[model samples]
Target: MKKKLAATAIGAAMVLSMGTGVLAGANLQEIKAYLNGSITVKYNGSPVQLQDEQGAVVLPITYDGNTYLPVRSIAKTLNVAVNYDGATNTVLLGEQAEGVALAKDFKNSSYHTKDPNLTTYGGKDYKEVYFDNAKSSRSSSFMLYPKGKYQKLVLQVAATGNDIESFYVQDSKKDIKLKTTTIAIQDGLKTIEVDIAGVEELFVHADIKEDGGMFVPLTTSYFK
Candidate 1:
């Protein structure tokens, strides 16, 4: 409805960042074409949700024991570059694309605990990185390697209003605050925000574990 399929042009290391909608709306006719499934499709070992132009989530179709996926959605998920020749009904999907993409890596603090069983959404397991509240520990470090100039980085953060205050993005000599909560990339969830305007390499740190008792989980965060 409101989101259309977009791609992150990254070289060598392929990173597929699909969370929420970035556009306002999609073509009405095209939207109806993709809403024809109820199964999740996994590309390169990660689950991907298909959506219509209206932002309503859709699914991959399974017919005759074979699963069919949205061509654009699948390509974006696996960092595969796709091109279509409408006249000949031909589609070309290529691995990776332009620009060097960044991967998410984490450094745990003393009190930032990680558990594989901590992340579950819509009855689906998301083996995301979960961090426990740190008391005597500092914020864990999040490393990002961006290729060129860019603006805005969206992240999925599960924390209350108070805890979010402890989060900040360290870009160059500036420590910028990530603001607000947005729609989750997963079907139904919420996330914290980040500002990555013109950032190359940066550090994402959340020192909220000092409050204790609470835990926060981070899902796949990407820059567009």
Candidate 2:
């Protein structure tokens, strides 16, 4: 991404004190901030191009040994909605929806696929899921922090090359198992839905009977 100077230095101040502290009152003030063109932002191993409202390239600002970037630009780039509430001085990123999140969208996952490729089954496009860890343990899992906002969980598991025994959902925070379902390749793809209302930390795991390149392909995983 190209690095260009902001239209004014206050641009940095606006971002530096967005929701809390100085800028919450929306009073005009002058503050010294430095524009460091050398700083580069990479999201998920890919370089991000930061820009401003007028399509001008924007660089990160350094203030009191802290660096700040344009949140609107970055969030929108990642396909997340961004909104500014001037009355409350609040910045909202993303919206509430029945489909709260996708499996590939979660960053706090363990022993699971990182870069999922588009795979098709049953005339539907699905993201292929594979275990990063070996098959000896016969399981892989991901962590989700819903913070009691969502009420439902839905996901599909399919076996492309081998049979999957089961997958389960759990509230890791409270050490409670929500639900579990068995997956049989002969039965085709299986959809597992569970009630997750008031769940804080959700744990989803898949148990495979055998290991293969396409052992457990998750067609869809989302929370409602």
Candidate 3:
């Protein structure tokens, strides 16, 4: 009978980022560890394949009587986001870390209009704005790919005229609506946050009154 080493997933919920380093002046203990290539990982009855950021297979390591696996790979498999603060040598799990600016990461494009215009309001310039023609009640949408790296989407929205109707957040890959809300132009600017856990692709949709107006959704921040 071959003795197989089993690795216990320690701190799988708190994963270390690829760039985070160990604490300073930490004592290092050297031990003889074995690399186990023939290990299977499973979740709920489903098998989980472990791979690095580059899609390379990562093996489990067995030291003494315990087995260890890569933290980032395990976190991703569990549908959790991992962030590291290099300045403080901290590992943040889920949405505990700071938010990421969406504009720097996501691509902007028009969904219904022939051309989307960039507008400014309250002394702040917005790059993604929805322009509606008064021909009919219409909607515009844009997409962002989170790939399970973010947990929430935070933004503020407002309409120039009385054409504000509704806002929706949908899981584009699953074709499911996660959240939706109606907006009133009299409310001025409205702030909203949507849960986006484990979502591969997300769609933000805005419904207008077709009264020839402008709708602006600002602040592209996401929690990781």
Candidate 4:
């Protein structure tokens, strides 16, 4: 992914400030509550429905007893511009404003698949996997282990184009089949929670329907 020099610099500065008392620490629930009351979100100055008035937003469940707000909503509320690169599935949210408080409890961690060939499926390549677009492509299958029981299954799906469609837990030995789904190419990042029973080795497969091609990226720390 090409770096936006300006955004990169800003993000770097924010990261540094995280430890220097610039950013506060809090839990996911606390951050959600704060966001509920503190900011109103507008996409391109138009109100967007990412959360509710009572702060009862349906967020992706994570392992650490935290919740992830949609990146788009947070960026808009914080007055940062967001961009996504379809070819790479790379999302860039412009820098946060000075003195703006970010969710103190949420830790930014990288979770990715290692198989280079795993990106493309059904004659199409999704440059990166996102929590928002997980329901695309019925042929795609990914695994999520909860903090411990049985790992959950996040299959590439096609429910409603707007919602996170379907998610559930499954035994390791079960053979799972995914439904087909597709998403329009867009620039932005989406977060999702994968329930891993425990900290165990998890595998996700991105198999392109055409020619039965498969590419797998190395699994990193997935949330929930």
TM-scores of the models, in the order given: 0.37, 0.47, 0.65, 0.20
| Cα lDDT of model 1 by residue, 92-172, tens digit | 444223322222444444433345555554465545555454445444555565422334455555553234445556664
Q: Among these predicted structures, which one has the highest lDDT?
A: 3
Location of the lowest summed lDDT over 10 successive residues in candidate 3: 11-20
Off by over 4 Å in 4: 1-171, 176-184, 198-201, 207-221
Task: Quote the lDDT for 147 in model 3.
Answer: 72
Instruction: Give the C-alpha lDDT of model 3.
Output: 0.62
RMSD of 4: 17.6
Q: Rank the candidates by TM-score, best first.
A: 3, 2, 1, 4
Q: How many backbone clashes does candidate 4 have?
A: 32
Q: For residue 212, give model 4's deviation from the true position in Å.
A: 14
Who is ahead in TM-score, 2 or 3? Answer: 3
- Among these predictions, the greatest TM-score belongs to 3
| Model with the higher TM-score, candidate 1 or 4 | 1
- What are the clash counts of all predictions, listed in order? 12, 0, 1, 32
Per-residue lDDT tens digits of candidate 2, residues 68-91?
A: 777766654554445555675666
Which digits, one per residue and each the tens of the lDDT, describe model 3 over residues 14-109? 224353135343344667877667667766556677788778888777666566777667767766665556656666657864677665555665
lDDT per residue as tens, model 4, 1-224: 32221210112111100222322432214422222222333344454455322345533223233333555435434434444433444454442122111121222223243233544444555554322123234444454432222233223322222322233323344443222223222311222233332223343433233222222212222221
lDDT of 2: 0.59
Report lDDT (Cα) of residue 61, candidate 1: 50
